[model samples]
Target: MADVFRSLNLLETLKESIEHNKLSDVKDAVEDLLISRINLAVIGDRGDEKATFINSLRGLSAGDDGAAPSQSPVAPEEMASYPDPKHSDFRLWDLPPAPSTSPFEPEGYMDRVKFARYNAVFMTFSQPPQPNTVEVFLEARSQQRQTVYFILFAAAKGTEKTLEETRKASLEVLTSQGVALPKVYLVRPSTLEKFDFPGLLEDMGRELPEIRAHALLLALPTLTSTLITQKKEAFQALVWAAASLSGGVSAIPVPFVASMVDCSVALRIISKAQLSLCLDDESVERLARQRGMEPTGLKALRTCALSVEVTKGEVKKRLAAAEKDLGTVSPKLVEMAMPRHARSASRSFTAMLQALGGAIEEMAADGGKIVAAALGEGK
Candidate 1:
């Protein structure tokens, strides 16, 4: 929301000032000092997978005459085959948490992502992808300049306990990286017509006033700008899911994003508003127990009220990003970075003004020389 404001350039303000010849030197300096800002896309890849679907919670039975609860390494295609449940996924890449026996490796065989740009990071386990862990990658993207990420073979569903683990894990990464975080927003839709998209966005902005602070760092402006900005257009397919989570509209303090310690305003906002992940429990869990352990009491990671919705291409890109996410950026780090940017803007523009003065001097010298030569010669 605030992206438009942060991107606002002082140079534009100086354009009027340039009309006066007295400040032409200043204008030259401003022009010279202008830094071309680029929209860099950093994508991380997580692996992809195939999962069995069944209507019975009775464990293929959710019990003993039940199908084995554990997946077998040697299980044949026939053993794993089950009726295609009406299973739909959440925003493109919401995977179930997959655990790993082997360390995170990039051998490339099972990895689904192929083409990548930006700083690509990978995250995965031997098991298939899960929803909660995927949030970590999403969180990482928020802290970066412009990021889009993924997860392969993830296994964490939108359970409470999984959310706790995800938050802890993300905090550790942010503590290490030391970068300002961006708004991590999830674009899910609501089933209750009362949850009108525009009203929801307005309410969300009210809940997190910080969103009005800076431009959200995103992979493609089109995805967030046109779609995410509009409730109906953005939440079209996503409305299938009950709820979604993302960072606050703006970056919060480090302590809030980190330990969730000391119980501050930022922490309160994060605990209440930011969603670590979202998905359709009806399609995936059905009769399975919905609740899980989560530390954030206010933000009880609920079983989504809506169905999951996403495009195939988005799924592919998200999965690819998951494979690459090795670190996370946190709000705590962003607060710490505030001091750096404070001096950056003022100093940069001042330097440009000085440079403009020098340019003016050179121009004046050249003009004087030309006039003198004209007089000395037969001009």
Candidate 2:
């Protein structure tokens, strides 16, 4: 109910801005939504595993351009930053390992790493909880950073019993060290589909701030159906913002001019959504390579025109098709939630909403199919 109210409030606000000719304000809001950043800090020993995990999170392999180095050269006291090649605003900072001293000093370490700047912290380890690790978690808690995670990598390849024992022992150690109810995720860095990695992303989506969570979801590769659905939801919100912006711009006196402007806005929005959902050519090829398949085969699975490329001709065709189905393509939930006055005020909003909403649905479907094909699920 609260979410519904928030959406309604946002719609009302946008409507008011459009009516009052505050298009600049609407434009700024849309821009901010599209370009939000998420800084994730990975605090672990610098090694191939840690570097591989960081690259995997960014949908890359070690040898991919802009991937984190397989062996970091930064000293133990410094931090190494790797930006997501697709989304520069989403960064991963590989911090130095926790101090190994018996008496753990968290303040100096935290300050040196600029811990507060990170939206989330992932502490990766293969062994039981060490004192320095516990101290870092405790300090993060004290600093009111609630999005910290304990990731146990390279521990999931063992038998189920061994994995359970590792988890139990880690939890017990953390409890003994006064860290209450610590969240630990056991993941195989090489294969996120194997274990707790999906759960970790779900937790982060719930815990991080709304904008950051959206950014994280869009920035990540479409690995699971759940992630594809989540990406759809995020892009739905983005489409709403973009539609509102289109409506605002349609306030221009010349109808043809307003239509042209809306088409450009729609093209930009759809292109960004394509990249976010990993429907672009490069992302598809990378995912194909990760799955050891030919890129052309994976690319063939995407049936939507906009899913593979966002050419001007494709956008026009999609828009024309959406126009014919406007009555059905306009999201029914959005229409029900919106007040009648707002709906009646702008035909352009409905048009853009239908066009972009349909494009997003098709692209999301394509993303799911690509993942399914890459994972060899339907075979």
lDDT winner: 2
- On a 0 to 1 TM-score scale, where does candidate 1 land against the true structure? 0.21
Query: For residues 1-379, could you state the per-residue lDDT of candidate 2 as single tens digits?
Result: 2242353235556656666667667776666667788999998877878988998888998778988887787776789999988887799999988989876689988888899999999998877868898898998898888999999886535887888788888888988999877777988887887689999998987888867887788888787887888788777777777776665556545356456556787787788889888988899989888889999988887888889889888877766776566566435544543344445534666667777877898999999988888777878
Q: What is the lDDT of residue 181 in candidate 1?
A: 54
Q: Which whole-number lDDT from 0 to 100 does residue 281 have in model 1?
A: 30
Cα lDDT tens digits, model 1, 153-217, are 22334444554455445545544444245222221111111112223234433332222211111
Question: What lDDT would each prediction earn against the true structure?
Answer: 0.25, 0.78
Which lDDT value does model 2 have at 287? Answer: 89
Name the regions of candidate 2 deviating beyond 4 angstroms.
Answer: 1-21, 248-261, 329-342
